[model samples]
Target: MIAERTEQADLLAGLRPDQWDAPTLCEGWRVREVVAHLTMPFRASLGRTMLDLAKARGDFNRMADTTARHDALQLSAADLLACMRQNIDHRWKPPGGGTHGALAHQVIHGLDVTVGLGLDRRVPPERVALVLTGMKPRNIKFFGTELDGLQLQATDVNWTHGTGTPVRGSAQDLLLFVCGRRLPPGRLSGTESP
Candidate 1:
């Protein structure tokens, strides 16, 4: 989590002011919104999070989306980055997932911003492998991917998953693909289009 946080902070720190408004792979969320979402767990209190979950009728997805959108409007890019840096060592854990969940959150969202911007921010293979190993079937489904008959092969790493129509790329790209991002062209190829 600390390494991912530092990598993300460095990447965001280098972005031009106008880039904050750029679109990310997270559908409606802009770059700033993604950053805001990244820092949400660090800034929001347990009571506030509970209230938010309640407001969404216990839908964690809605809570996260709405909170990210709402919080982005209240924070600047610099503030978002600062929050991330400040909480690099934070031990925020979800109900079922502990530190691994936090690491996955950081890595995946970090890719959402970087890949969405068409930037060349490659997450280290070690970190990507960690997240890959931690991915549960429910987690993949929650990310909106249907991997029933698909295979994932990482060209830049030894990791591979599933079997059937192969989707191949670098470990980072493969991670993003599994997480439901339509990667930029040429980043991935399959025996047939996925």
Candidate 2:
């Protein structure tokens, strides 16, 4: 986990100021906004998250928009990177629970930035596995709406689980799907493809 954080920090370390304004794959989000959203996963308390969740109607976009607004106010790219460096080593979690919470935040949002930027950086296999394995429970319990009933199959790995029509693609593609990137529909195949 520490290594994953470090790797992400390294990834964010090199961005120039102009890069922050670049568009990302996350619909209308800019790269800097995504970085701000990624930088501070554990900064909020659970109560804050719950409040935000309620306001956002339990939508991830709500949570993201909450943080993005906060980031837009004061977070420069350098500040976001600094926050990652200061807090990355701390075992972090989402507002709700689990050690893997921070792991998911880092890896998934990392992809949001990297893939969104067209960086073509493949996520580390072990980190992806950590999220895939850990996220199954969370996906089922907390964010089950988006998943519906799609059996996700990763051609690049042994990931096969859940219920419904199967979607087969690269591990990264599946990762991006769950993380909410509209990766090439061509690279992905499954009943879950949306």
Candidate 3:
């Protein structure tokens, strides 16, 4: 998880200023908003997070969106990068989500920024495999991706999920798809690509 966070910080550090405003795979979030959301755990206290959640009427997604947008507007790209770099070793994890969830959060959001900017960054295969192995039904449901009759096959890795119309791509692309993200053209192929 530390390594993943460090890599993300490095990536952000190298981005051109204009790229900071680039759209990301995370819907409605530009690069700035995604970075703000990623660093929220490092900056927000548990009490403040709970207060924000209450303000959003207990909707986690609403709280996240509101916080990210506000933070993005308030913090510059350099500030967000500094926050990420300073907290690379932080062990914060989502409540009830453990270390694996922490890794997944970094990897997925990193992809959101990279893939959105059209950067060709490949997450390490082992890390992708670990996230794939740890996926649960609730995770899929949370993303609202309906895969009842669809199979996900990673052409670049020996991973397959479900059993029906095959959706083939790299493991990272498949991960994005499973997380309710739509990939750019040519990133995915098969009967039921997202």
Candidate 4:
């Protein structure tokens, strides 16, 4: 987790100022909002998080979106970067989600910033494999992607999941797919590429 966070910090450090406003695979979020969302766990207390959750009427997605947007407006790009740097060793996992969840959070969100910016960053294969291994049905349901009849095959790594028509890509791209993210054209190839 620390390694992932540190690597992301390094990646963010090299971004051009305008890149911070670039749209990500996260739909409505830009680079700033994604970084703010990534660093949120480090700064928000459990009670505060619960309050925000309540404010969003128990919708985790809404709360997350609200907080990310709010924090993005409140903090500068440099401040978000510093928050990530300072919490590289912090062990805050999503509720009911253990260490793997934390790692997935970092890897996916990191990709949100990198891939969204059209940067050619490859997540370490082992890390991608680990995350793939940890994927659960609930995670997919939460993302709301319909993968019932589609197979996910990673061309760059020895990982494959699901069944039916194959959707092929590098493991990281597959990860993004499973998380309900659509990649730019050519990132994925298959009958059911999204």
Q: Spell out the clash pairs found in candidate 3.
A: none
Give lDDT for model 3: 0.91
Candidate 3 residue-wise lDDT, 51-145, digit = tens: 99999999999999999999999999999999999999998988877988888899999999999999988999889988988988887888998
**10 residues in a row with least lDDT, candidate 2:** 136-145
> What C-alpha lDDT, on a 0 to 100 scale, does residue 192 get in candidate 3?
45
For candidate 4, lDDT tens digit of each residue in 1-194?
98899999999999999999889999899999999999999889899999999999999999999999999999999999999999999989888989999999999999988999889889999999999989898887888888888888999889999889888889999999888887888888785445
Cα lDDT tens digits, model 2, 1-194, are 68777887887788777767877766677877776776546466678777887888889777778778677567777777788788767876655747777777677777777776778678867668777877756554553337766788787667876688888877767877776567754768754434
- TM-scores for the candidates: 0.94, 0.78, 0.97, 0.97
All candidates in order of TM-score, best leading: 3, 4, 1, 2
Show the lowest summed lDDT stretch of 10 residues, model 3: 185-194
Candidate 3 residue runs with Cα over 4 Å from true position = none
Candidate 2, superposed: residue stretches over 4 Å from native = 41-64, 137-149, 163-165, 190-193
TM-score of 1: 0.94
Candidate with the larger TM-score of 1 and 3? 3
- Compared with the true structure, model 3 gives a TM-score of 0.97
**Cα lDDT for residue 192, candidate 2:** 42
Residue clash pairs of candidate 4: none
Model 1 regions more than 4 Å off: 191-194
